[model samples]
Target: MVVGARLEGIQLSGIRKMFELTTERSVNLGLGEPDFQPAQHIRQALSDAVEKGYNKYGPTSGISNLREALANGARKYRSDITANDIVVTTGSTQALMITAQYLFNPGDDVLLPDPGFVLNVPQVRIAGARPLMYPLKQEHEFIPQVDDLEKLVTPKTVAIYTNSPSNPTGGVMSIEDIRAITQFAEDHDLWIVSDEVYDQIVYDREHQSFLGDYDKVIHINSLSKTYAMTGWRFGFLITKAPIIDKLSILNYYTIACPNVPTQHAALAAMTGPQEHVKQMVNEFKRRRDLIVDRLNRIDGIHCLVPKGAFYAFPKYDFNISALDFAMECARSDLICTHGSAFGDAGEGHIRFSYANSMDNINKGIDIFEEVCEKIKG
Candidate 1:
């Protein structure tokens, strides 16, 4: 018998290698990474830190100043957090894993949205827990239904995973929706692991989170999207004292600590001039509007204008599988992620990332239109 079970066929390296192979000649839009570089101030901060010999390992949780900046940033959404309740992780990915590891047991059920972030479901499974999916209807703009979520809970349910300004779908759950879910979790005594990495990139509406109202919420965010610091791998998690302590101990054994230089860079990003972030969000909004309008005009494609984030999840009329459509687009030298890669509920949809230059966005849409027209014919 196997001594221990390992998570099979779930390596990020495999996906990355496939992406690298396809991107060599393709106009790649398959990644969630921002196309922009970190701001000059952030780069200078990291350089200065390196010059000053700030390369030594810091605390397992995070450096003092960076933790303070993270706490300050969290106050905008919910003012209940302090540095003591924060654990700076390598990225939101690690934060999610730590939460799953500590909160879940074998055969425990963790609820996640259908068509959710692909890695999250597998992460729950790898943590020795069963993943229970709750459907987010297209008619509802892909927002989580509180009633549906409430129905999925059982004694085996340990936590619920939610992403606002959600991946692939670009769905931002409203404040009221968040309140309902949090109340349900509170009533059920379950943990709410919310991924708010795209919280600052919202377009039409304000971003909301449950960290302020509920103590059982574990909020994870990063500087990757908003600050264009994906390569920096800097993220932080906020939870109540007990959960923070639990995650911190697991983090200590997993990665030991996040990079010192990246921590300094994140501090600069949090405390730096707000103008850069505003510029990026404004630019993304422009791209988003352009893409949504163009997609709406196309035959057989129905796209909901996203309120937050830089993605457009649009349904196509052709009965072909989402993977087939995505592959067809890739064959046409235009790259986008297939909805089915997210989950079964994602069938008949495709995700378009607008994290490219305006010129690329226009060209990419043209290519997509041409390919789609051919298919319709």
Candidate 2:
């Protein structure tokens, strides 16, 4: 059997490729994963759910209790959203895929951020659309400028995909930036897909949502980062009833429903004591500060202080290409993502995730500093 021609232009994520190439002895600083495990209460909830026989297929929209709990939690920030507006999916990745499939037709162009998540471009292509990139310059704290977005929009542009507390860079969009983007979407009648998986992990500022000002925004979130439940494969979307209806059908065809036991655990994560979240955020903040400070102190590597999330995107003074630099690091047993994996504009940088222990982070830096000396221009 022949593969589909649509996949001819797409390639494997460079991040995952690098990850696979690393040996067991490698000190990983690549993937944006939380080092913490799932909270005890959440794990116990899943265990209890399994013992109580909640293993059957659930409603495609989600189990009702979890949906209501999610709605209530979300309403604390976005008051207009209701239980009817949320649909649980396999993960935020799938939530994004559903949004793209629902909104984009073949050849439709969707604006995404440069120096964004590695998966964003491929996901857009899988939906049969062209991906247009808007710059998220380091000088601008990695926030997308409205003027750049406007320049990229054409009649074929159908949507804008945004990630706050962005992956590959821990840059959180400012409230002013959010307002400008929401207004732009309004003026152009374009759908807005907001990836907010890291909403709970912001360091020094409040997490702003496009949902606060517009119903046209589709908000996607998950328990992965916040609760350290990456393997759980649970995520969801918040939108109005009509969109929810369309997503429900799409979800049915795709996942049938999110895993039942995990959904119960996700409900516990949403409605249980939130102090666990605060604790995790605090730990991540500590790691973020430690890593960023260490990186900035290196002679040729300068990292911007990330306002949220747990990554440090540092620009380097090295003359080598990002790919060669990353591979060189790997040879030294220091694993990291090359910035160019995210987009063309990411050529001169590398993304380091502080999701490991403080001890590992410190150890990694010692090796990183040594590698920098070798690669110094």
Candidate 3:
């Protein structure tokens, strides 16, 4: 009855714990899942696939149509990618895990942004590798500073994990920053694992994929956030076919293949009319503005107005731990993720998702303000 040493450092996600408190009465600010269901056309696509007996195992690299569609989508951002470079995955989570497993050896150091997606550190750890944290400074609007990342590099460093329109913070990296990071990766001969799941959700800026001029970047994307298809478990990875060959072998042993009908659903998600996506982004932007404004009106609280994504990471001057604050909020029928759940770098903050309706968001803020007052006294 021996557990693997590779999993010793990993724990269940803190966001999951906060999610358990959700009820009809609770204002759920935790978890980044979109409140909307997949558009009717996407569901129709899934139904059509199932009716056509598309439920069998798909190729490990995914169906050819879906792969081609994904490549076309990538070309809108980076012109050189092709279907051969794409490997449809079960989800961005699995794609990231497979990439980590393929790119890192035991005891290798992978640089990760502190206060990153909660799974980022654990994914590296599960690969029998160490995660070195680079600061995403509050002073820098939560963007990773090149100097800070450079200072953390060591002989064991093998890769850098980057997320734009970042989770919890909603900070999108600029073109110049992307170029600097890409140049740094080139200079060091390190691989870049780029998480661009929120590529379509940015408000003020365009997404600049690290793969723009860099062949060293491995791009991870998902239909979950873009098409509101989280439960469908569909995503894909982009890298050279040589790396895709290795990841396909890993996939054969892991998921065997992504769900067949869901891949068809994802194909529809990719090639279908993109107006639904644009509408979703507009709604999210409105909610983001609403939540940031409401949080800023609270005394001692300052929320950095996010440039992209639907989550806001708000800093507070309260003299309490983030976990304690979150627990108290949960007791008051509010569920928000604690900042420390992200990392030590996030200790004094809390993450709020604006994925819910504007009415619910306002209600949640009212509850949050009341809780703040109660705690202050």
Ranking by lDDT: 3, 2, 1
Total clashes for model 3:
0
**Candidate 1 structure, TM-score to reference:** 0.96
Q: Candidate 3, which ten residues in sequence have the lowest lDDT sum?
A: 1-10
Candidate number with greatest lDDT: 3
**Cα lDDT of model 2 overall?**
0.88
User: Which stretches of model 1 miss by more than 4 angstroms?
Assistant: 1-4, 9-18, 21-25
lDDT of each: 0.85, 0.88, 0.89
Q: What is the TM-score of each candidate against the true structure?
A: 0.96, 0.97, 0.98
- Runs off by more than 4 Å, candidate 2: 1-3
- Give lDDT tens digits, candidate 1, residues 43-139: 9999998999989988999998789888888888777678989998988888888888888889899999888887788789888898889987679
TM-score order of candidates, top first: 3, 2, 1
Report lDDT (Cα) of residue 142, candidate 2.
92
lDDT of 3 by residue, 1-377 (tens): 36787777578999999998777889888869889889999999999999999988879989998899999988977887889898888899999989988988887999998899989999898888899998876789999888998899998899999999899788999998898898888888899999999999999678878777778789999999999989889988998536789988988888998899999898888888989888989999999999999999999899998988889999999999999999999999999999888888989999999999999899999999999998889
